[model samples]
Target: MQGYDRLAAVMAADKGLSIFRSFKRLNAKNLLYLQAEIVNCESELDEIIEEDKNSGDFFREKYSTSVRCLKEGLGDETPKQWVKIRQLRELLDKYNTAALQYAQILRLKPPHAKDREVFQRWLKENAFCSTTAEFNQWFGENDENGGDLVALFGRYENVDALTRWVFRIAIPCFYKLVGYRKAKGDVETGMVYFDDDKIIRATRVTSTITSSAIPATSMIVLYLVNHMAWRLAIIVVYNIGFSMLLGLLAKARRVEVFAASTAFAAVQVAFITNFPRD
Candidate 1:
């Protein structure tokens, strides 16, 4: 009886030790996964910043060159002059499209409705030509050389001003958004790290309780088996029932751990998806 008691104690101790070691390992792995995610977010932010800088530089250079070409084409009155004007108009359209894209990437707010309405009214009053038909009508209304050229130059200046306005408002707001996003990422990372620590501590407590309880339970079972010979069969049945219950509990714990990991991954996905990357 004494030998059997020692064997039961050894088995219970071994099971408890194994559970503790496995949980500790799982905690470490979870921490590593969280750290990796944090690093990925940081790298993505750096890439976005670099791409924005390159885009801004490209547009600025192209805008300057386009302005220079328009100025040089001002004096000519040939068919080639009209073709150059058409090409410049197309280029300005492209610039506007690019500027809108830049603004979207920076998450800039649009102008107020009243301001847009006023700007549209001003364009109509000034007979600002956007289409080829409007341009031809305006050109026919003015003298071919002096007034027409001056009107074209004025339109170009207005377009340039609009581009500058978008950049001026969006660029500052972009920097602020970047700062806000970085701070938010930091806070989230800290929260995840803190939660991981708490989980590990809780796991440690569970393991300690499990380790202490297993041996005490085994000893109690051993005493019952020795003192009550007739109830030994009943004790065996109870032991099997308890063992099955422990197995189910361990399985549930594993499922819970997996659920937690999935939840963390979902949080990361939500953050990345919600952020404007344009």
Candidate 2:
């Protein structure tokens, strides 16, 4: 019959549409999973990059102080001073290692000749010296000036300034050189899309609880006031006590949730680390 054929065709079309929608949903979920993995990888890389920057900053601070002392005729001749010098040297080495590792991890290829030349020129002009010879020459000229290269450039008011001008100057340059924008973009996106969802869900739940509580409280108050005026004062006190108890319960729940989330994160880390990688 014609009606039977039409029904059969309609059923087949519905089935096909359902299968197509399911396939699309699965593909979408797969894409989201891949995006999450990429974001996590970038976050880890950003943390490492931040560590490298911190090490570099530490090295610069220690190096500047040590160099200042040396220029001021405060030689590291004593055992204590020598130990400090050795520690500073170790930090410098650590900074260099971190920088190299960062560069390798980021796969930073050699810069263009023009860009390299420009950077070298900036180093010469701003840093007071670009090479070892120039550095030695500058230090030797310290007697001509009242202070050393750092003082000559007026990099800081004094040794106690701790906030190094050179470090501040280098930050923008390093940020560009390290290609931090990509990592920063991924982090921003993840925060907006992933973290925002959690925040929104919490807000909705809190709103629902609050909206429900207000009406319920009002109804209880009204019932007490109308039916039992004598016991109204006691009911009010009871309501206040119940509210305080609820507040404490909410606080405890938050603490428990925080602990559970921390545990889950730890387990995830352990699982990922132990899992075989190809």
Candidate 3:
């Protein structure tokens, strides 16, 4: 009876081991399928972009909000098309993230079943949490209270926010384009930001839908200067007749002034051509 009981215990252990091994194999197969699916989706997206390159009418029509058109296909199908593509890519990204984290957790090889269970639970909870704050909180860590990754990348709060928006709005695109993980540590130098801390905080909620070669603050200043310059030019042109009445040589003065204006215009053109707007 004692011998039979010992044998039964050994058989149970063997069954558990077999089950674990089978799960590992299944996971590997799923990961491979997901990666292949991502590649296929990427190729299809490229084809779509190429087809719409001429007038970019596809992009324009897709965004149009006209009431009559909205009732038809454009409102529903156009947005829906992008949404479906995004979901596929997002799933692939989550798979990759999970695999990487799981490999790390496995390497530690916890000595007890309880330890292993804890590690598994941690991975399950943290794997899909989008932001570092959520991940830290899930682990029972006070992310906001501590000197967290958010503070370290304080320079890039705006950029990070935009990245999140891009991911949410363009799911397929978010997955295809490599994204910066909102972890609580150093992000790579490739992540962009503004010099002004105030700008970063202020525009943290702003979208990066439009690309700008210059910093947002600098771009704003340039726009204001140009607007004021146009107004100043208008004022100067309006006062030209008043200047002509100041002297009998007003006609000759006007000719001289016109020649000077043409020369200045040529100089301005040369400057603009040499230094293109970012």
Candidate 4:
């Protein structure tokens, strides 16, 4: 499920996120600081220029050679006003860069990618997605209760999106399969309270079960077919399916999928080739 501004949805969600000050705090603070620094530098440089501009001997022909040396010193390309100009330039550069970054960061409505980063960080900090409040916060129609957001998995597109999907599916399925029902008034609110901790633990256990089952599932048919050519064909098919499944379920990158598939195929091929032919 995609997370949203559902800070309004739950009664007990992290209040820090609810009152997040990304715009007011981040952009305004940086902008004001940069602006002040630049202004101060401008004032200071103006004074330096005013003072030093007339004090130099370039106005006197008697000091022409000395002024030329100051102006054209190969040893130091910028001999006059260099420090002030550099400092001003660096400040302006910093301001320019911060402006561009803050444009993305300070929008009234941020881009989805930015939201994803923010919500995902919140999830990491508070473990939001695995909570009963999170589920209820985003479970259904928004209405006055404030849900109505898309589920956070693929849509928000955070880290371990697949793992989040697995958690969502495994939690409900675990309860159903176990057929555990609490007696009425057994818990707070007397409402159905999904045990997120147990669900997460169960999801991990299910993941462990899957780790045992998969990667090998692709090769199970390898031993059933005896002919060398057919076995080779099966191996090729297995590698393709294996790679696809790994990408789909693990959300792995192409390089990761390629590396794992290559490693597995290499080992499987070695064992098959070295074995007795049927």
Question: Among these predicted structures, which one has the highest TM-score?
Answer: 4
**Please, what are the lDDT tens digits per residue for candidate 1 over residues 1-278?**
22324323432432211111112233445545555554565566455445534555554234334655434433453223234445555655655565455444334223333233333333344443556554343223342321212110111122222233333454336546663554432221111011223433454465557645754564454444433443345345545544443443343354655564455335433433444243
Candidate 1: stretches off by over 4 Å? 1-194, 224-231, 248-278
All candidates: CA RMSD in angstroms?
A: 33.6, 31.6, 27.3, 11.2
TM-scores of the candidates are: 0.19, 0.19, 0.26, 0.46
Q: How many clashing residue pairs, candidate 2?
A: 0
Residue 18 local lDDT, model 1: 12
RMSD of 2: 31.6
User: Which residue pairs collide, candidate 4?
Assistant: 1-151, 1-152, 1-153, 2-151, 2-152, 142-148
Question: For model 3, how does the per-residue alpha-carbon lDDT over 1-278 read when each residue is reduced to its tens digit?
Answer: 22324323432432211112113445577777777777777777656544444435755354333434323434446543355457666977777886885564344321223222333353343354556654444223532322111111122122443333332344334334643343232132111222244433443323232222213433333344445455345335433432332222222355765775555445444443454444
Q: Each candidate: what lDDT?
A: 0.39, 0.38, 0.40, 0.54
What is the alpha-carbon lDDT for the whole of candidate 1?
A: 0.39
What is candidate 4's lDDT per residue for 146-186, written digit by digit as tens?
A: 22222222322432444555445654466567635642322
Clashes of 3: 3
Q: Write candidate 2's Cα lDDT for 168-270 as tens digits.
A: 3343355567646543432211210113234335544654575467445644444444334333453455445444434432333546545644553354334
Candidate 1 Cα deviation (angstroms), residue 241: 4.4
Ranking by TM-score: 4, 3, 2, 1
- Model 2 stretches with alpha carbons more than 4 Å out: 1-87, 91-203, 206-212, 219-230, 233-278
What is the Cα-based lDDT of residue 110 in candidate 4? Answer: 26
What lDDT would candidate 2 get against the real structure? 0.38
Q: Which scores higher on lDDT, 2 or 3?
A: 3
